[model samples]
Each structure stands twice: as C-alpha cells, then as structure tokens.
Target chain A: MFLETVLLAQRELRRNVLRSSLTVLGIVIGVAAVITLVTIGNGATQQVAEQIGSLGSNMLQLRPGQGFRGPGGASSDSKRFTLEDAQAISNDIPGLAAVAPTANASTQAIYGNENWSTSITGSTNDFLKVRNWDLDSGREFGDGELQSGRAVCIIGATVKKELFGGQEPIGQSIRLKKIAFQVVGVLKSKGQASFGNDQDDFVLIPIRTLHRRIAGNADVGGIMVSVRDADAIDEAKSAIERLMRERRRIAYGGQDDFNVGDMREIMSTVTGTTKILTALLAAVAAVSLVVGGIGIMNIMLVSVTERTREIGIRLAIGALGREVMMQFLVEAVVLSGFGGIVGIALGLGAAAAGSVVLKVPFVLEPGIVVLAFGFSSVVGIVFGFFPARKAARLDPIEALRHE
Target chain B: MNETPVSSNNNGAAANGAAANGALIRLQAVTKVYGTGIAAVEALKGIDLRIGQGEFVAIMGPSGSGKSTCMNILGCLDVPTAGTYFFQGRNVGRLTQDQRALLRREHLGFVFQGFNLLGRTSALENAELPLIYRGLPVKKRRVLAREALASVGLSGWETHTPAELSGGQQQRVAIARAIVTHPKVLLADEPTGNLDSERSREVMELLTALNRDRGITILMVTHEPDMAKYAARQVHFMDGLIDGRSTEGGA
Candidate 1:
C-alpha cells in the first residue's frame, strides 16, 4: 500500500512537471547558496590558520611602535632598538628561547651577469631559530664570522634562483653596495606568504658585517622574541614589557615608544572574525530555507483546494484519512528531497568554481552536506502537514459536490 | 450467497429464496438530522429498511426527499443521527470512522451520478483504485482490474482517460471501478442521470444483467420510473419516510 502511494505521488508530480519544479525551486536555491558560502569560508579559515602557523610558534615581535602595527607601521619618529636590547631580553627573560635583532636595507646584488634587487636583512644566527627557518644547505653565520665582521651571507631560495639559476651558490661571491659577500648557506623554500608576497625573496647576513660594510650603521628596526614553551609566553610577555619600558625610559602610566605584539593574539583575532562571518552567512542561508519552506506550503495548500474532486474520489473508494495524508506528505518530501540532491550538485560545482577564483582550498565537509539534505526533508514535513491534514479532513460528500 | 452465481432466468425464484434467508443489510428506525437546534432539518425520520442477499431494490424519491441521505447511510459514507444500521448482521453504527472505511473497502462499493472517475487517470488505474486500498499485489490487481473492465464492456478502453471517453463509456469505467473489489453490495446513485434515453436504457440493461448473472446485491437511488422498473422491487420515499413499496421486495 505504501509503495503504491509513493508511485501515485510520483505520477501526480509528473502530471504537472512545470508547477512541481517551480514549487521546489526555492529549496534548491536555498541549499545551494548555503553550501557554496560555507565551503569557501571553511577553506579560507583553514588557509589563514596554516599561513599563520607557518610564520612561527610561540613568538612575539617587539617593534618601535606605541601599539600594534598599522598600515604605515608604528610612529615613524620613534626611537629604534639597538642590538643591546636583543641581548638584554635574552639575558633578563627567564623563559626566552632565542632573541634576534634585525635591520633591513634594499639594494641590488650582483653575481656574474645576473643582478636582482632584493632586501638584505642583517641578523645573528639566532634569526633562524626565532623565525623557525631551516637551512636548505651549508651553514648559518658562525661566531667567527660575526666577531670578525666578515662578509658571509645566506641566500634565500628566490635570490639563489634569480642570481645563480641552477649553479651552486656556496662559496660564491655576490656584490651588494660594492661589498662582496660570500654565500655560506641557502634557506629552504617557504613559498608565498598569506599576503601574496614571496617569502623567499631576501638575503641574510651577519649583523656586524651589515653594520660595518653594507648598511654602515648599527640601527635595529625590530627584535623577534621566541619563548621556550606555550605556557611561558604570558610570563615572558609581561617581563619583557616591564624590562623594555624601563630600558626605553617610559614614565610610569605613560604609553611606551615600542610595541610588543603576540603572534597568538593576532591569530586569534583573525580566526574569530572569520568564524563569525561564516556563522552569519550560514544563518542567512537558513532564513532562506525557511522562506523556501513557506513557498512549498503555499503551493501545497493551493493543490489541496484544486484537487478537491480527486480527493473526494479517493475517499469514496475507501481511502482512510491517514492514507490521504500520507499521499500528500510523500509528495512533498519527494519534491524537497529531489531539490536537495540537485542543490548539492550545483553547490559543489559553484564552490569548486569559487575556490579557484578566490584561491582558497576546495573543502567539502560531509556533515554539512548531510545536514543540508536532512534539513530540506524536515522542511517538507513541517510545511507539508497543514495542507496534508486539510486534504485528509475534507468531507467526501462535500468534496464530491465541488466543481 | 443464498442466490445463484450463474445467470438465472428465474429472477422471482432467486429473490424468493433470499427473502426466506438472513438479510444482507438491515436499517431499524434510522433518523438523520443535518443541523442542530432551531436550524435542524430532518433528512430521515425514523425510517426502516431491509435488503436481502442478491436482491435488486430501487429507491425512488424527489429532490430533498432524503433518498440521497439514505443511500449515503447504506454506503457507509455517513451514520444515522438516531437508530441502528446493520451490514451482514454486524452493527455499523458502533464502528469507528476507520473501521467503517474498512467495511466499505471490503464489503461495499459505490457509483456516483457524476461518474466520479478520477480525471487524467487511465480507466484501468481508476478501476484498480479499490484494490490498492485493499493492499492487493500488482499482478493480481492488474488482472482483476482488467477483468472488471471487461465485465463492464470496456476491455478496449483500459488505457483511455475519462475525458477521452464518451459519457456512456465513462459511466462504464465507473461501474468497473465499483465492482472491481467483488463487493457484497453495490450502491449506485442516479447511475444514468447524465445520459440520454438510449444510453440510460443501455446502463439499466447492464445493471439488470449484472444482478441476474453475478447474483450481486444492488441498491440504487433514482428518480426516473423507467430506470426504477429495471429493479425487482421499488421503494418510494417522500418527506423522510418510506411512503410505498411495489413488486416482490418485502419479506
């Protein structure tokens, strides 16, 4: 009996195929929009977390700024950090793992016939430790090279590619600002950063060598601090803040001239914003689903009134009230279930396209797909009951009399 | 059944045997009121009726004379406001709505004046509607539906929609639908009211042949004296009461 009712429902739907399709259109669009938006959002969130994690772990950046870095960075006129500050942080902080003071200068490097313009940063061997960078080959700056101020440098992947092609760069000399620096090491490829900039496009040299020959000054722009463990970060941050305030000569209760920003804090801020945005998009999609359900209810009510005589015939032929109700209910669920399937296909296609266009990963979570489909069927049940009950409760005699 | 299954030329003898046996249906002092209080209008006032197995009885009355209401009660589509109705010696008034529907599905069939065949459905499908409610499997349902349509002289019109068939053909499809379940009783209301004289006579002849050939009990409500004459007996209803009876029906 149930099998026959389902067949009857399918035939009824097929009889007015155009109207049936139109009625389910809302469900299709609603499900599609929700799936597409959520997929792209999840992909973006994942990309953000991965990129942030790649930068460093349990580290903080201390710069010459009153607060977090803005578009132009901190107040430009503020006094810069000296290498002594990096030494002081390492010596004074108990849980410190490494401290690296960096000063940067943009210059053209020449080797053979190829010359590429790139930023040359000066730092100690601890720079790699603080930034979580690994050497692809050769060695970083040794104590002898730093103490003697020798022109020994480590070339990044992009600089090596631009200046040396396939040639080996170790023991090779590259001239920066007329000073010849021997490449003692090569940094591994880190690919592009989240901001679309090449991460491997710079060269690193000993701080003393950079100050004595290339940069001709001992001014450090920033200091990177790495804590020993995640649990030590808060203590390290507070101790460093107190020490820096005292060293920088800031009065009590007055804002300092430098900024100490925790990488985790920045990560949390970005993650929170994206999570809220994703949830908001999902809420909007759910609202549209409800609207879709209302659309189904409206059409079903109209159908009950229109098929009065047909309902009358079924009733007179000994159909019980529940049978009539089941017929209409099954029709509604079948309609929405079909719409959900179509919507899933369309949504995945749209999300794949959007992923390509936005450069985010293509993410398909099975939970959301199942949820969307289940919710659509539930919409049919919730919205279908009223019209089905109305059809079931119709008087056989009066319905037969209906034109 | 008390009557003969094969076609019997001796209709009087068969009806006589039924009169001496248990009745297939019995209505005792049944009354039906449409509304309550001051607006109440009585449709059946303490009316009593009995029909035996294999009997063909025509109920004749003018409009608003409660003949339709009496037919609805006998068809199990409605219940009396006061008094009792029995089908196959079982009290119908004590049954619930779903139970009544079961009784209708298993023991009774109905044919409407409008020919109430579902529109846009094939004749075979319409004839098979009752079997679906009866939960019969597809193979048997199709065979029985084909046989019912053949019995109604619509064997070639199984796939035709009601709108595709003429009025007489549609009525035949309705009849096929009514008898598809081999119901114990067939209640037809104005079976030929929409047909002309020739078509009406043809329908009457078909009903008479079904009664004599299959020994199926038939209760029909009609206003036309010509149509009523086809039945073995006729009962006249006037103002919610049985005013007269004619021919061989009474026990």
Candidate 2:
C-alpha cells in the first residue's frame, strides 16, 4: 500500500513538473546555504587554530606588565628583566629547556646601496630554541662574539632576500644606524604568525652588542621560555612565576608585576572567536529553512485545491482518508528529498571553491550533511501535514460535484 | 408504482429470483438538508427506497429533483439527515465516515459522469486503484486490472491515459476500474452523460453485461430516457421524493 501511494505521488508530481520544481527551489537554496556557511566557518576555525599552533610548541612568554595591557601599566615602578634574570631562571627551573631575554628596536639596515627598514632583535642563541626557529645557513653566535660583545648578527630569510639580493651575505658586513655588523648566519623562513606579523622580517644580534652599541640599556623587553616536556608547561609557569616574585622582593599577597602567557591560551582565544562567528552565521542561515518549509506548505495547499476532482475520484473509489493523506504527504517528502540531494552536492562544491579562495582548509563535515538532509525531510512532513489533512477531510460528494 | 421484476436474459432470471426478496440497499425516510434554518435547502425529503441484490435499477429526474442525492446516499458518499439506511442488512446510518468508506472500499464500486480517471495515469493503474486501497500486492492487482481491462475490450490500451483515449474508451476504462475489485454493487452517476449516442450505448451495454453475467447489483442515475431503457427497472424522483416506479419488461 505504501509503495502504491508513493507511485501515485510520483505520477502527480510528474504531471505538474514545472510547479513541483519551482516549489522545491526554496528548499534547495535553504539547505545549500546552511551547509555551505557551516562548512566554510569550520574551515576558517581550523585555519586559525593551525596558524596559532605554528608559533611554538609548549612555549610561554613573560612580559614586563600585568596581563596584555601593553608595556605601560599602574606598576610603572616595576623593574624590567635582564640577561642575569634569564640566567637565574634557567638555573633555578628544573623543567626549563631554554630561556631567552629579548629586546627589540626598529631600525634601518644598510647593505651597500640597498637599505631596508626592519626590526632588530637582541638575544642569545637560546632565542632560536625558545622560539622553535632554525637557521637555513651560517652558524650561531660564537662564544668569543657573545663574551667580547662583538658586532656580529644573523639575518632572517626576508632580511637576506632584501639586503643580499642573489649575492651571498656570509661573513659580509651590514650597517645598522652607523654601526657595522658581520652577518654570521641566515634564519629559515617561518612564514606569518597567527596575529599576521611577519616572523622572518627581523635580524638577530647579541644582547651585549644591542645594549652597548644601540639602545644603551640592560633592560630586556620580554622573556621567551620553552618547557622541556609538553605536560610540564603549567609546572614550569608556576615555578618561573614564584622565582620572579621572590627575586623581585614582592611582599606576600602582592600582585606580581610580570605576566606569563601560554601559547595554547592565545590559540584558544583565536579559535574561540572564529567558532562564535561560525555559529552566528550558521544560525542566520537556518532561518531560510523555515522559510522554505513555509513555501512547501503554501504550494501543497494550492495543489490540493487544484486536484479536488482527482481527490474526489480516489475517495469515491474507496480510498480511506488516511490513504489519500499519505499520497500527498509522500509527494511532499519526495520533493524535499530531491532538493536535499541537490543541495548537498551544490554545497560541497561551493564549499570547496570557497575554501580555495579563502585560503583555509577544506573541511567536510558528514554529520552536518546528514543533519541538513534529515531536517529537510522533517520540514516536508511538518509543512505537508496541513494540506494533507485538508485533502483528507474533503467531502467526496461535494468534491465530485466541484467543477 | 409497480414492483415488477425485469430480467434481461436466462442467467439474469435465476440471479434475480435469488435476490428478489433480499434488499441489498434499503432506505427509510431518508432526508438530507444542505444548510441551516432559513438558508437550508433539503436535497432529499423523506425518501424511502429498496433495491434488491443483482437488480439493475435506474434513477431518473431533472436538476434539483434529488435523484443524485438518493444515489449519493446509496453509495455511502453522504449521510442522511433524518433516516436509517441499511446496506446488506447492516445499518449504515450509524456508521462513522471512515467505517462507511471501508464498506465502500470492500463491497462497492463507483463510476462518475466525468470518466474520472486520474489524469496522466494509465488505464491499468486507474483500474488497479481500488485493489491498491485494499492493500493487495502489486502483482495480484496488476493481473486483476489486466483481466478487467481485457473484459471491457481494452486489452491493448492498458498503457493509454484517459486524455489519450476517445470518450468511449475512457468510459470503458472507468467501467473496468469499477468492476476490477469484483464489487457486489456498482453505483454509476451519469456514466454515459458525457458520451455521444454511440459511446453511450457501448457503456450501457458494458454495465448490463456485468449485471447479467457477474450478478453484480447495479444502481445508476441519469436524465436521458434512452440511457434509462437499458436498466430492467426504472425509478422516478420528483421534488426530493420517489414519485413512481415501472418494472416493465423485467423478470
């Protein structure tokens, strides 16, 4: 009986092919929009997480301020950390893998006639270890250079490309603000960080050289620390915080002047924002599903009215009320089901194209596809019930008599 | 009014005798009103009727004379306002709408003036509709529909839709649909009204054959006297009442 009703519904839909197609158009658009929006949103979130993750593994940054309030805060009296403080933390902390006290200044570097404005970072060889960076060529600062405060520096990949052009820069001299420094090594390309900063646009020099020849201060801007084990990050952070408080001579219950930020916390903040945006866009897209359902209901009602005589004939031929209802309901389901299939295909294609344009990972969520399809079928049923009931409740005599 | 029995052939005679005293359809003081109070129109007014099993009866009247209302009540398509109706000894007046539909589904067949086959549907599927409602398997229903179509001389026209066939062929398809379920009674309302003279004769002949050979009781409503001549007995309605009856040339 069910199969026969389905056949009947197919015939009815086939009879009015144009009208049926138009009716299902709304559902197709709604499902496709929902799936495509969600897919792109998921891809964006994944991209954000991956970009943040590439900054460093199990690393933390301690800055001379409370939280992320920039360098100036109410604790203006707080003292900045120096190379000695970095040495103390490295010696005192058990799980410490590398501790580098870094200070940066924006200056122009001159290589013969080519001069480019770039930031210069002053740190020891441990800076590369803490930042998870590597050199593509050349060697790190030798013990002689670090101890004697020699004018020696390593250029990043971007700096190498800008200053050297196609020429070799090893053992070559570059002038930074009237001070000449020998290029000891070149760093590998690290690409852009999550915050959209170019990591390879800086030159690294020894802390002693940067303090004595440039900034003329022993103050370190921040401390970058890498934990020996991934699971020991929290312990390392606590140990470092306690040591800093004790060395700074902070009274008990007094707030520490320094702030320690984990890489994972920054990653979560970025990913969380993307997730919220994705959900908001997806919710807006879901409203169209309801609109599509309303379209189905409207068209079904018109169909029932138009086929009054046909319904009358079925009833007179001894079809039960529910049977007639089933036929119409089945027609509705078939329409929405077809729309769902077409929508899924279109959504997948659009999402793939969108991912390419947006430069994000193409993520296919099978669960959402199934959910959208199932929800469309449910929409058919919910919207179809009213028209089917009206058709079922029609009086055979009056319906037959209808011209 | 005379209650003479009319038999068209020897087979019809024996079948008619068996059903002569058994009323397959009985109505007592049946009244159907269309609306409420002053705006109401009584379509059927205190109608009393009796039709025996295997009997071929024709109901004839002009527009608004209640012939169609009487046919509707007999077919269980509408309920009477103030009367009891019995079909095969069961009180149909007390039956719910769904129960009435079930009774029609199991034991009755109907033909309409419009040759009301579903548009865009083939003849065989139209014929198979009642059996489909009966929940018969597709194979069995198809076989029965083929036999019914062949019986109506439409064996090779099974795949033709109503719009693709001539008026005569469409009426034949409607007849095939009516008899496919082997119903005990067939109710036809102006079945030949839309056909020409020749096509009308063909449809009437088909209805007569089913009544004579299969012993299926037939009740038809029509306005044309020529169409009424095919039935063994004739009942006349005037102003929502059964005015007279004639059973001339009957068994």
Candidate 3:
C-alpha cells in the first residue's frame, strides 16, 4: 500500500515538474550554503594545525616580556639575554635538545644586479635544529668561522632564489648592507607558516657576527629552545625559568620579566579561534534551512489546493484520509531529499575550489554531509504535515463540487 | 488499516437479506439537515426507500431537491440525521468512518459527473486505483484492470490518458475503474452530464450492460429523462421528500 501511494505521488509530482523543482530550490541553496561554509572552515582549521606542526610542537620561544602586546612591548625597555644564558641553559638543563641565542635585522640582499629586501638572523648551527630546518645543499658554518665571527651565512630557499636566481648559491658572496657575507649552505624550503609568512625567506649568520658587525651590542634578542620530547617540556621550562631568574638577579617571589611561549599553546589558540568562526558561519547558514522549510510549506499548501478535485476523486473512490495524507507527505519528502543530494554535490564542489584558493586542505566530513542531508528531509516532514492534513480533512462532497 | 468483512459474494447472507423483504438496502424515515439555527436547511426530510439486489434505480429530481443527499447517504459518503440505514441487514450509521471507507472500497464503487479519471494517468492505472487501496499485488491488479477495460470495450485504450481520449471514452474508463473491484453496487452521479448526446448514449449503454451482464445493483442520480429511461426503476424526489410516483419495470 505504501509503495503504491509513493508511486502515485511520484507521478503527481512529475506532472508539475517545473513547480516542484522551483519549490525545492530553497532547500538546495540552504543545504549547499551550510555544507560549503562548514567544509571550508574545517579545512582552514586543519591547515592551521598542520602548518604549526611543521614548526616543531615541542619547541619554545623565550622573550624578555611579561606578556606579548603588539611589537616589542615591554621587551624594548627590559634587559635582553646574552650568549651566557643560552650556554647555561644548554649545560644545566637535562633532556634538553638544542638552544640558539638569536637576533635579526632587515637588510637589502645584493648579489650582482639582483637585490631583494629580506631579514637576516644571526645564530649558531643549533638554530637550524631548534627551528626544525634542514639544509638542502652546502655545509653549515665551520666551528672556526663561528669562533672568529666570520662573515659567512646560510641562505634559505627563498633568499637563495632572490639573490642567486638559477646560479649555484653555495660558496657565492652576497652583500648585506655594507658587509660581504659568503653563503656557506642553502636550506630546504619549509613552505609558509600558519600566519602565511614565508618560512624560507631569511638568511642565517653567526650570532657574534650579528652582535659585532650589525647591532654593535653584546645583548641577544631571544632564545629558541627545542625540548627532547613532549613529556620533558614542563620540566625543561621550569628549569630554564629558575636559571634565568637567578642569573638576572630577580629576588624571590618577584614577577619575572620574561615570557615562555610554546608552539603547542599557539597551535591550540589558533585552532580554537578557527573552530569558533567555523561554528558561527555554520549557524548563520542554518537559518537558511528554516527559510527553506517555510518555502516547502507554502508550496505544499498551494499544491493541496490545486489538487483539491483530485483529492476528492480519491476520497470518493474509497481512499482513507491517512492514505491521502501520506501521498502528499511522500511527495514533500521526495522533493526535499532530491534537493539534499544536489546540494551535497554543489557544496563539495565549491569547497574543493575554495580550498585551492585559500591554500587549505579539502576536509570532507562525512558526518556533516549526512547531517545536512538528514536535516533537509526532516524539514520536509516538519513543514509538510499541515498541508497534508488539510488535504486529508477536505470534505469529499465539497471538494468534488469545487470548480 | 480497518478491515471490514466483504459481503458482496456472500450468497447465503444475501439470500437471507433478500428473503427478509426482497430488498438489499433499507432506509427507514431517514432525514438530513445541513447547518443549524436560522441557517438550517433540511436536505432529506423523513425519507423511506428500499432497493432490491441486482436492481438498477434512477434517483431523479431538480437541484436542491435532496436527490444528491439521498445518493450520498446510500453510498455511505454521509449518514442520515434521524434514522437508520441497513445494507445487507447491517446498520451503516453504526459503522465507523474507516469501516465505511472499507465497505466502499470492498463492495461499492463510485462514478462522478466530470469523468473523474485522474489527469496525466493512463486508463489502466486509473482502473487499478481501488485495487491498489485493497493492497492487491501489481501483477494481479494489472490483469484485473485489463479484463475490466476489455469488458468496457477499451482494451486498446489502456495506456491513453483522459486528455487523450474523448468524453465517451473517458466515461468508459471511469466505468472500467468502477467495475475493476468487482463491486456489488455502483453509484453514479450524472455520469453523462458532461457528454454530448452521442457520448451520453454510449455511456448509458455501458451502464445498462454492466447492470444486466454482471448482476450488479446500480443507483444513479440524474434529471435527464433520456438517461433515466435506461434504469429498471425510477425514484423521484422533490422539496426534501419523495413524491411517491416511483415506477418499476418487469423484474
């Protein structure tokens, strides 16, 4: 009985194919909007986590600040660390991986006719280990070069491309400001960071060279430390904190003037913000589904009135009220279900294109797809009931008499 | 689903019912009033009527003369306001709405003035509607519908929609639908009202043949004297009451 009624309903809907398609357009757009926003948002969050993961999850950055507030903040007035602090943290801390005392200056890099403005960081080979970078070609600075503060540098992939073009960069000379620095090695590309800054756009020189030749100061800008593993990070951070406090001559219970920021903390904060934005976008998209349901209800009421004579004929032929109700209800469900399928296809396609443009992963969440599809079908039932009941409750005599 | 016992082919009970008063249906002092207070309009006022098995009765009257209301009560589409209606010795007013629907589907069929064949539907599917409501399998419903169409001389028009057929042909398809269920009684309300004289004659011939050949009782409401001439009996109504000049042909 149910199957027969459904077949009849299908034929009835097909009779007015244009109106039926128009009626379901609302559902299609609503579902498509929801699916696309959620998918793109999820992809963005995933890309953020993956990009931050590439920066080494167990690494920590120690800067001279109570808390980060824009650029420099209190760190400009507070005392910066020196080379001894990096050496002390390395020797005193157990289960420590590597530490690099680093400072940076923006300079115009010139190799022959090509010149590009880029930042130059000064540190030891330990900087590569702490920052999780690898050399693509050429060797690191020799110990003698580091001890004598030789004007030698390692160029990143982007810097190498900018200064040397297609030419071999290793053992080549590049001028930074007035000083000539020879490129000892080229680092492999690490792509973009979470915030879209190019990780492979800087040149690395020895710390002493930067302190003497560029800044003319013995103070280090910051310390980059990589813990041995996740389990030892808390212990290593406390140890480094105690040593820095003692060396800096801070009294007991005094508020420390430095902040230790872990990559993990930054990763969670970024992912959390993106997740909230994604949910907000999805919620706004959901409002359209309710509007779509209203469209369904309006169309259904019109349909019941248009088919009044047909309903009369069925009732006169001995169709129970429930059977007539089921017929209209089935038509509503089928229309919305078809809209759901079309919406899913359109949304997934749009999400794929968006991912490429936004440089994020195309994350296809199966649960979300099912949820949107199911919600559309439910919208049909929720909105379709009133019209179906109206159709069923019509008086056969009056309906038949309707002109 | 309400399942009502079908008494269409129950020969023993039907014989007993016929023996009771030589009638298959008995309506005693039936009355129908529409609305209430100053707006109350009595459609059927103290009407008594009886129809024997296998009898073709034509109910004739002017508009607003209660003929349609009488037909509605007989078809179980409605109930009388003040009296009882008996079909095969069972009180029709006592049956619930679903049971009346079951009785309609199982033992009675309906034909309407506008040839209420569904638009965009093939003739065979229109004929198969009641069978579908009865939960008949597709294969069985198809075979039965084919036979009914053949009996109505529409074997080759099975796939034609109503819009594709002439007025006479559409009425024939409606008849095919009515008989596809093997209904013991067929209620037709001005089945030929929308047809030309030629088409009307063809439809009357179809109804007469179904009555004589299938031994099915038929109750038709029409004001056309030409159409009324085809029935075995004619009951005239006026001013919410029967005029008591009913004529009977040889049994």
lDDT of candidate 2 over B15-48, digit per residue (tens): 5454443667767788999899999999999876
Which candidate's TM-score is highest? 2
lDDT of each: 0.87, 0.86, 0.87
Which digits, one per residue and each the tens of the lDDT, describe model 3 over residues B166-185? 98999999999999999989
* Candidate maximizing DockQ: 2
Query: Per-candidate DockQ versus the true complex?
Result: 0.51, 0.69, 0.58
- Candidate 3, clashing residue pairs? none
Q: What RMSD does each model have against the real structure?
A: 7.0, 5.1, 4.4
Using TM-score, rank the candidates from best to worst. Answer: 2, 3, 1
lDDT of 1 by residue, A1-403 (tens): 6777778888998999999999889999999988898888888888877777766758888888676653224446789889899899999889888999988888999999999999888998888998789999999888999878899999999999999999999999999999899999999998877656677998999888888897778888888888988788888998999999999999999987888888776777676678789879988988888888888899899999999998988888899999999999988888887788888888889999999999888989988899899999999999999999999999888898899
Grade the docking of candidate 2. medium
2 against 3, candidate with superior TM-score: 2
After superposition, the stretches of candidate 2 with alpha carbons farther than 4 Å from their true spots are A1-4, A67-79, A107-117, A144-151, A172-181, A208-218, B1-21, B245-251
TM-score of 2: 0.90
Which CAPRI level is candidate 1? medium
